[model samples]
Target chain A: MSASLPSTSPFPFPRFYNFPPFFSRQPTLQTHHSQLRKWSTLILNYCRHHRIFKLSLIDALDTELLYNKSLDKRMGIGEVREVVEFMRKEGRAEWAGEGGKGVGGNEVWIWWRNPEEWASLFYEWVDDTAQKHTVLTLYELTESEATISQEFHGMDPDLLQKALSILVKRGKAQVFGQEDQQGVKFF
Target chain B: MSRKGVGLAAFDRSRITSAQYASHGNSLRSSHSTSVATQLSVFRSLLQQFAQTHAKDIRSNPSFRAEFARMCAAIGVDPLASSSGAGGKDGGGSFWAQMLGGSVNDFYFELAVRVVEVCGASREENGGLIGVKEVKDRIMSTRMEGSSEITDDDILRAVNTLKPLGSSYSTLTVGPKIYIRSVPKELNIDQSAVLEAAQVLGYVTVSMLMINLKWPRARAKTAIDDLVSESMLWVDMQCAEWEYWSPGFMLGTGDDG
Candidate 1:
């Protein structure tokens, strides 16, 4: 089963990933906290490496991120939730649903870069290209040929909207049109 | 009595002989001390020259450095000894620091700082008791490629250099492995035994301890619990019988998965 993982340049797992005890929640308070810290770092690095912006706890269970097929050790859903909750407290993760507690949520936003960071990137790109006064549709900003080399390119539209909303709030950019087809004009 | 002369003349002659003897002994003693001082100065200069010439090798080569340290120890010269107490005459710093232009002492001092960092950072994970090899690996891993290689011996020396600071950092030997214990905590006999058993398989269950050490179940459980509370052991509940793992195992299994 371990052999079936895509061998094309896999994400380098930390040494402790093979440690069986890492899958089990430590009973000791300090050890558990340390375990959580390692898990948090691994999750962030893994998502950033794969360019994964959102994670579904259920789907991730079957993946190598949560399961080590070689060791036959897998983190249970509750354990994974606890890790996500830990990340949430650190502001590195958030539940996908609005006004929904993360306790029952299956999906989460892994904020490798928080909205403010993404907004700044968008602002910098606009400023660099002298497109400050030009109007760009949400699709054009993320999917356009000009932005193909951007880190924020091919970003999730919902996340893109959230980032643009920050710019709008700062009066750095203005947003208009329908929710599905929004046009942004940066100042 | 006639050959020796009268009493007053005999007394004067005896006094002159005694004065002559005292002068001759003072001259001999002064010459002996002068030669000894000359030999010591020659030895000091030769040692200084050797250190100056091989300073680079001393810093870059771990074995050469260790051999040099051992040679100093054999001669009753402490290379890492702080000169603070004797600095009034020779300025401040260590003996080696002055002789080698501070490179050798600085090298160990810098390495000691790194060792302290690794211990402090992993204290929460391993309860401030970390394997010497693990500490070396941690330090080497963080170093840049092509940098000087650090050995376990070097780490031991670095820890030794921490003695003057009165820090709790000390080396310990448990079950054939030397560990750097950063917290001033002591392990009981049973706890150490369980730790030794865990070294074999990277972990040990209460049943394993009970059967191997002829320990009762309660005795085994207490030792494991003590280690767990100290954060020295992490308990894995996924197995049928919970296995207590030594955090040292985290760095040992690099080939798996």
Candidate 2:
């Protein structure tokens, strides 16, 4: 069990991470539930620590997040996809779209911070930046030097749109854009 | 416990000395230590003769060996410990422990370890549980140096010795049969009662649980499903009746209708 993974891993892998059977889906109900729960937590924590906003099944395997090359053990793609789906059900992640990176299109958008939490953070940033009642492109909100120190900088565009939509629903911001040019004006 | 076990030394000596001489004399009371010494020699020879003559029977028959063990216990002699060159005075029984296959306790202890190993090898399927009879069969099949008269009693005795090691090994009773568990998972009362009903042919179904335990459909399913998930019982979904058999168990005690 002492066989360790790459020291570069974002999160401290659990002790059972070295157990060979750790990757195999446990057939028993209680054991299976516990395994899924632990895997889901590990996935969330890993992505959050590495500022990882998107994770497809293929990239996850190569990153040594779902597979341990040292132990020659890996969670099958299907098993990993199931864990992502479980995270989605728990509101910790969301499907990227009707598409995926790998064959099955099982790519998922990992949401380290749920939309509500991100929206509140964005609203705070806008308030502190004197951007209230001023129009700003989606790019300026996430990419500009004004928001460089923000934890949510370089956010996924889809997630940025969702965060703005939350402020829009409360009449705190308004979104207006053409087909390729999008911008939001906070009120 | 060892106190009571050693109590037989004085009692057995007095009886043997009293039986040989019918004379009522104060000398017998005065020479108590010498009388005990003479009686011990007589008793040792008698036990030695018994072991030499019954050596074959004890080796071939498990029940007879168990009886012999009981008698040894009655006289405060351990069939296993007396042979390890440990017991200083009761030395004649060392041959008995040897004749019965090199310390009965050692044989059984070895078997107990194997039983747990096999049961735990496939934890996902077996839940570290194997039938007690299956344990006996596996031990008998193994070609050990001595003591081929392996029986369920020996298995039970060896398992009892493993109890102090922790909950890793234990004997579970289901109806008239026993199952050995090499893990510490707890079995709730309802789950136990469900297994108890399964002793008839080594299996149970939801319908069987419903009828035997007089349970509602949901109640029966919950208990059976718990057992299945725990791997304490196996499910045969292909069967029309949905049989849940605990493999490597099921010694029919004729209680089944």
Q: How accurate locally, in lDDT, is each candidate?
A: 0.88, 0.69
* Cα distance off (Å), candidate 2, residue B185: 4.0
Model 2 per-residue lDDT tens digits across residues A1-187? 1221212454666544544445667657655555677688778777776667777777778677887777566788888877877887798877776533333465677777888898999888788878888888888888887776676777878778888789899998899988447888877
Give the TM-scores of the predictions, in the order they appear. 0.87, 0.42
Q: Please, what are the lDDT tens digits per residue for candidate 2 over residues B1-257?
A: 55553575888888878876645455666588788878877887787677778767665678888998789889887665555444533455555454544445455567667766656553544566667776666556564767566778777777776665655778888667688877787788888888778666567888887777889999888988887788666554433576776644422221111
Record all residue pairs in model 1 with backbone atoms less than 3 Å apart, i.e. clashing: none
Instruction: Write the residue-wise lDDT of candidate 1 on A49-77 in tens digits.
Output: 67687899999999999999998889999
Colliding residue pairs in candidate 2: none
- DockQ of every predicted complex: 0.46, 0.04
Distance from true location, Cα of B182 in model 2, Å: 2.0
Which ranges in model 1 have alpha carbons more than 4 Å from their true place?
Answer: A1-8, B1-41, B82-89, B255-257
- The list of candidate 2 runs beyond 4 A from truth reads A1-187, B1-45, B52-64, B73-106, B141-149, B163-167, B239-242, B249-257
Tell me the tens digit of each residue's lDDT in model 1 across B1-257: 57757778889998999999999999999998999889878987898899999999999998899899889888777777743335533656555677888888778889999999999999989999999999998888888999999889889988988988999999988989999999999999998898889999999999998889999999999999999999999988878999889999998886432
What docking tier does model 1 reach?
Answer: acceptable
